[model samples]
Target chain A: MKGFLLQGKNLSRLRGRLKSALLVRIAVYLLLVDLAFVFAYPFLYMMVTSLKSPQDVRDITVNWLPSGLHWNNYRLSFSLLGYPSALARTVLVVGGCTLGHLFSCSFVGYGFARFSFRGKSLFFLLLLLSIIVPVQTIIVPEYIFFSGAGFLGTYLPMMVPSWLGFGLSGGLFIFIFRLFYISLPRSLEEAAGIDGCGAVSTFFRIALPASRSSVMVCLVLSLVWHWNDYFEPLIYITQQKKYLLPMLLPGLYRIMGGMQDASLSGGDALGDIYTEAVAMAATFLVVLPLLIAYLFLQKKFVQGVERSGITGE
Target chain B: MKLSYSQKRRWSGYVFLLPWLVGAAFFLVYPFVFSIALSVSDLENNNFTKMFFVGLANYKKAFVTDVEFVPKFLTVVTDTLINTPMIVIFAFLTAIMVSRDIKGKGIFRALFFLPVLLGTGFVMQQLQGQSIQSGSLEVARGILLPEKLQAYLGYEITGYITAFFNRITIVMWGSGVQIVIMLAGIQSIAPALYEVARVDGATEWEMFWKITLPMSAPILLLCIVYTIAASFTGSSQVVDYIISLAFGTAVPQFAYSAAMGWIYFLFVLAVILLVFLMMRRPVNRVAQR
Candidate 1:
């Protein structure tokens, strides 16, 4: 009878522990879902709205689900955006800038990381200033300089600065690379030096390859930034044929005309409702490449963020 | 004839820094000085050829004469002040959530980081336009707050709550990078530390407050600075206003725009400096601890 009582108490205690554990798990999952929804809501909304027909969008009862799939909207948006050419140009600009950043930033970062130089701290301060100062502050002079150099219609204004390690958030990349390199063990570089490898050679052959995570971080980030950069491209690329992907957005409405008429006519207009679907479709197309790339590369990206020593030791 | 080791190192360092040195001299230093010159000069027909010295007239106009600049600038300032904390806190929480040992952790991280890819520039602008331009506010409020709760909270309270919800939508979207950084910071806290805390009878909450929060203070400051920079530079009312003043006006007020830009830049610098100053003691304490 004593043994039975003891077993009963043990079982009850076990059940109590399990119950709380279950509650905690439930709570954690709830919080996760709650936060995730906030980030996911707009994308999901865009996706669903993109798939909705004009009539379905305006129907009072229709909320989440559409009556039928509207592939035509995607078709319309694709043609309107001239997806192929825009994608090609975006790839060119984003690719060049990313490459420029990868090489130039890592090089400069290596300098700051591995060696002490005169004015090093002062230079670092300037790097921080570059990160903080709005490009708008200096864009006027930059515009004048570029226009005078007859480089306004070209990608040089964007790509050249990036190549020299002062492009969009280039300082941050340099900072990241510097941190990662600082944390690296010195014995390898020392051994390489002992074997008569020059500093530049050692950096190129050993240090650069070793900091793969930082490179990945720089690559992914620079790509995203350059891809999403609208203002710079807008200011420089005046030729319609030269417009990048983001530049396509502001003009999407006018290019895909007939929708504005319904928008102008107050409410309950078919054109008004369908325009959203098409616009959502266009937006989705614009982000589609990066979104897919992220889905595949997210693990690497997250790992890159962690291992890049961005949260510095 | 061989160079000393330190001398060799310095020479190599200069070589590596060559790109930045060249780039900065042309792109950074020149533009900086030129912008200052532009801001202080009066230009005819917005051309440099017709420019002359104007001293602080443009700055004076921005402060004392321009009606639209101050209010818009103030709005940007207040928005940043309110938005930055909420973003940082939300990101911290989301980072904690993502850092947990859970199933499909990759999916959660990807979902959370989606905004970093899409939140800025054109995609965000388009989505925001669609929602605001359409009747989505009504739908959003309807979904966010039920009728019973709205009635219970009263009209004014509900209005405030809905407004908060709207703000939170933007906040959540802006937190992608912060979440990633915080996750990294939290992950860097050694598991051994947590184990030790657990052995010492610390609950999760206690462990977080006593250990994680204190340790991650530096990273948190970095996030705050980053958030401020991102908020100011990202597409916003102030940026739009500044750009319009520069280019959108019939006679591009070149000097006036540069002055306003300088004014805005100073405000941003001040805020960033303020953040650093405010967080210094706590961060130093963390370092000491």
Candidate 2:
């Protein structure tokens, strides 16, 4: 009877401890949610303000919530931004850049990881230096070179270097692939080699399949960078029709500013000046594809990011 | 192994390296040498034509005569000093918190990472209006919170407090990439260390300082380098000033802009190298010990 009583007391004590721990965990969870809200508030505000009417947006006091959703803002934004053409151009540039980087960087990475040769260390050091050196210093010469090649105003200047595996090597993609290749088992390759497979075949049959996660990681990063890139397209493509999304949005903003000048003579000037709400809608349209891509690929993207050791490696 | 076959295989390795060798020679090495040459030359007749070599004259003009150089450079430096510490600390703390068991961890990671995807230029423009407006809004709201408390504290204390506030906002905006990096670092650490600490009856705070901090040093260095690089590359103030000087209505000159870029590049290079050397020593010691 005494033993049973001791057991009951001990059980009660354990239950109390478990309840307190659960409470602590809940508190931590709430704190994390609050922290995320703090960080995300600006983006939410931007989205909300975008939905507000021009008059509402321009008010001296900021409104935390829109009075009502303005759907026409989006239609106006599309026409005002010339967003269709911009979207097409952006897709072309990003797609072309992605393909170029994948082909060129993968080949180069394969070569470095698999081969042993003279000047290999020296070549790797040069690659590292390429990463360290700021691209700004080289922009002038690159512009001059591209102009001389008659590749200016075309997507070639942006897309072709990636094909040559030029700027892509210095990025973490190369290192990640290299490390991944190092960790891969060599017996598969050895067996293939013994079966009369060529180097290219071995790479295709064995290494390529093994590095899918790394490849996905590279693709996502390349797409993001290329999509967001404003400066290169700005410098190279002076033609408004060929401008990518980033360039196009800023150009639209500029055009909007011009239209805002009531002194303009054209009949179309007033029509071209989008409402403030429309401008916000236009911003959303510009970023929509990226957001869509992020939504679908978020799982693979996170996995790839976690595996790439981007912060740690 | 047969000696003859080994020799043939070794020679084939050189053949495999041919593409990268050609690429480096044409793209990297050539441009590096050409940059040095271009930096010294003078542009004539609308930037399409070039004149004779000007030696260190361009560098001299940037350092000695350029009006905007010093102020822009100072702004960059000041911003870097303000922004980097907050980012590093917040990233570290977030990593610690997220590393623990929690619900919706993935969503939290995504939230932190979303801003990095927004890129610098867009984010800066968004911040430009919001930051200015928010300052006024806060004042109008008459919130007697941190700012009021700081004012009551001495002037130096107030300055530090304001500085802290500026950094926190910057950090909150910029934490995406840093948080992702820190998360990877935290994940890479063997869980066994934590388990060992728990066995030793170590407190959470003690374990964090003793184990987490030391193990995370490599990643911390990477974060510092990335943050610094991102700051210079992404600063809208720098970009706007330079672009205006380069292509703006006021002096549309390529040579002057090139000169300024070279100067900025040199300064950044010096700082990066110094930091690299300092960071490298600790990593080496850690490896040795």
Candidate 3:
């Protein structure tokens, strides 16, 4: 009878433990869902609004959904954005810059990771400084230099610095590569060294091959930054004909006649024709390629960042 | 004539770094010094050849004469102060959540990181609807909460909600990279440490405070620095004003723009250095352990 009473007490304790664990799990899930909604609401709003017809957009009752699918918004924006050319140019610049970062950043990173030399600490400090200083601070002089060099209005100004590992957030890329390379075991490289493989060939053959995940992280980041950035392109490519995708956005706003206050414009016929829906559609189309690429690369991208060992030793 | 092994290694390191070194001289150092020179010299009609030394007049204008400059600069400073801590804390918390052995961890990570993909560029600005003038605060009011709810919630409560959502929007959008860095830091911590703590009769809360936080101190510092840099450099009123000064106006005030940029850069650098100095010793202590 005493043993039976002890077993009952143990069972109740276990049950109580399980109950609190369940409650904690439910609470965690609730918090996660709420945060997720906040993160995702902007995208949802954009998508829904992009599909709304003019009448539906005007209707006060319509908030989340449109009365019907409006394909015309997409159609109009697609044609008006000069989608094909702008997209091609964007791909070209982003691709070139990505390739540039992959080549130069890794090479520089490998050097820092594998070799020790004089002023190494000082160089690293400068690298940190490079990352900290805003590009705008030095852009005026760089612009003047590029203009004097006759590189303005061409893609060279954008692509050359990246190729040399000094482009947009280039120092950070090198730092990422350095951290990743430092984390890797030296046995393979040492073995290759003993085998007379030479440093360059060893890097090309073994080190670079093993650092694929770091490469992936850099590639995604570089591509997205270059794709989204309008500032440098705006400064360098002054000609309207050579405008990159992001540069075209502001111009699109101007053409939509939507830059002025809508109420003051009094909802003119052109404003109605080009409406907020069309603008959202253009924005959607602009981001569609990156979004699709991200969806496919999501798993690898997250894993790659985790494996990059960005938290230094 | 043969070189020592250490000498060869040093030479090769320089060889690999040659491109970057040259690039830095031109891209970083020259531009850095040249901008300093430009700040003190007035240029007319984009003609550097016709430039004249203005003797600190541009800096004086920014500080003393230009009414728009000081107020806008202060706004940016205050905004950075408010936003940086929020981004860092929110990111660390979210990183902890997603790093847990939860189901759909990948999806949660992706959603959390969506801002890194879409937040910076034209799409976000366009979506925020006033395009040029609308800040994140305007964005929250315009879209996040419905018009009816704002009316129902009344002016004061709605103002509070709008402000809350404004901060949330900014923090969530900016914290993506920080979250990734923090996650990496947490995951890199040894499981053995946690096991030992548990064996010592420590609770989950204790383990987090004693093990997770201290071990990730270096990364926490990094995330703080990165978020601070992003806040300063990424789209802000000061940056926009500088851009307009240099390019947007009919007669571009290149020297004035350079002066203003330098002021902003110095302020940002000062803040970062102060933070680094404050955090350095603690981070090193944890690292030594």
Candidate 4:
């Protein structure tokens, strides 16, 4: 009787364990869903807030969804913010800078990895230490130096540095490229040489092409970084026409405030709150292109991060 | 021909490195020297030629009389200290979860990483500006417990959570790279060790501490460094404040601003150094074992 009772207890315990396991799984799933929501809510909020009619924006009792989309906010913001010129300059600066990083950083990396140059140790030390220089600390002198040389308000202030391989996070780029090149077998270079490829052509045809993934890594990263570099552009480009996307987005708030929209004068004192919606609309417009680019290049970006950004091994 | 062959290899290296050499001089070395000059001089807005040396006065003024700089800097330093570990641990835990055999892992990974891309240039600026300007600091109030629960936990624990509460967005946004790094670390841990641990009747929890954590020492160190560096350089806290002071409408105090930047940077370096020292023993032990 005692043995049978023990079996019965054991079976009951087994059933209880199974039930708890199922419960735990459900809890995990719920937690993950909540995390996803937390991560996504801001972007979703940005989108919903942007599309709200100015009335819906100020009404405290309104539902989460907008009653009607207000498309005019985008148009008003664009012209007032000088969107066309800002967009052009942003592309020119960011695009040119990314190209410069790819070429300059890779060139340096190839040399460091493949050859024994004079003062290599000193150069290497500088390269390593350069990683730690806070961009803010140098801004004062850099600005003075640039503006003193008749560059400041021009794109040259940013473009020239980028072309020289001294743009933002340039050291990290060089490090990553050097690492990638080092890992590639030295036999490959000898093979290229045996095929009568000169050093320049070998780098161009063999080494460069082999570093396609690293190039993608630098390209995507540099593009995003330069595109969003707020302070460098802020200090350098004072002209409205020279504003980048980051610079222009903030300026749109002023433009929205200046707009003579009839919807803003609802006399509720709370009607002043509609500017929040307009500001969000302006922000959404700024982020839209990058989001589109991200959607398409999502796999490549993540892959690059995995391969080059933080691979510990 | 033999000499030429050997010399060609040496010469080509310098040729390739020329751009970076120029960049180092103009971009790296020059700025560093110029920064020292500015910090030690009574330099003012765009006035390059008429600067006078002021020794450590600007640095001293930052602590003694400049009310805005000292308190603002201390708050930022404290915030960074509290935030970095929380972000690293949270990322590690989340990475473990995502690396499991869960459904829709790809989508979740993408969603989680979206913040990193968004938080970079304009979006980050907008987020900071909006929260500060629009007085939405109460956004994290949703995380508070019921009154009964709070009472049960008492004020101290609850207060700690509340203090950490306001930093939720910064933590979450700052964690994308860390999560990726942690995921890679977890994945890199040898599967054979876990199989052995299981055979030896080890629970998943034990396996984590014994197998996973030890194997991931280097990666964890990397994550800590990355977290500290990213938060220091990326955030618009003290750096932004200094920038504003440097370019404020009244009159730009270049000397004072340079001194302030250097002081803030020292804190960043100190934090990184502290973490590296703390982790070094465990890392060496792990390697030895």
TM-scores of the candidates are 0.93, 0.86, 0.94, 0.86
Which candidate number has the best DockQ? 1
DockQ of 1: 0.74
Q: After best superposition, candidate 2 residue A36: deviation in angstroms?
A: 1.3
lDDT of 1 by residue, B1-289 (tens): 8999999998898899999989888788898899899899999877688889989999999889989888988888899999999999999988987798888778888888887787776656655665566524433577779989989989888877877787788788889889998999899887999999889878788998988898898899999999999999877787888888886778788888888889989989999999999999878987675
Candidate 4, DockQ to 2 decimals? 0.56
Off by over 4 Å in 3: A1-13, A257-268, B44-46, B127-154
Question: Which residue pairs show backbone clashes in model 2?
Answer: A311-B181
Model 3 chain B worst lDDT run, 10 consecutive residues: B128-137
Query: How does each model score on lDDT?
Result: 0.84, 0.69, 0.84, 0.75
DockQ of each: 0.74, 0.40, 0.69, 0.56
Q: Which stretches of candidate 1 lie above 4 Å from their native place?
A: A1-19, A254-260, A263-274, B130-140, B151-154, B285-289
Error of 4 at A246 (Å): 1.9
Q: Can you list the residue pairs that collide in candidate 1?
A: none
| lDDT (Cα, 0-100) at A88 in candidate 3 | 94
Per-residue error (Å), model 1, residue A2: 17
Residue-by-residue lDDT tens digits, candidate 4, A186-295: 78889888887888788998898888767876776677778777778778878776678877766665545454243355444433434657777778776776778778
Candidate 4 segments exceeding 4 Å error? A1-25, A82-85, A254-274, B1-10, B43-46, B125-139, B143-163, B199-201, B281-289
User: Lowest-scoring 10 consecutive residues by lDDT in candidate 4 chain A?
Assistant: A265-274
What lDDT score goes with residue A260 in model 3? 24
Clashes of 3: 0
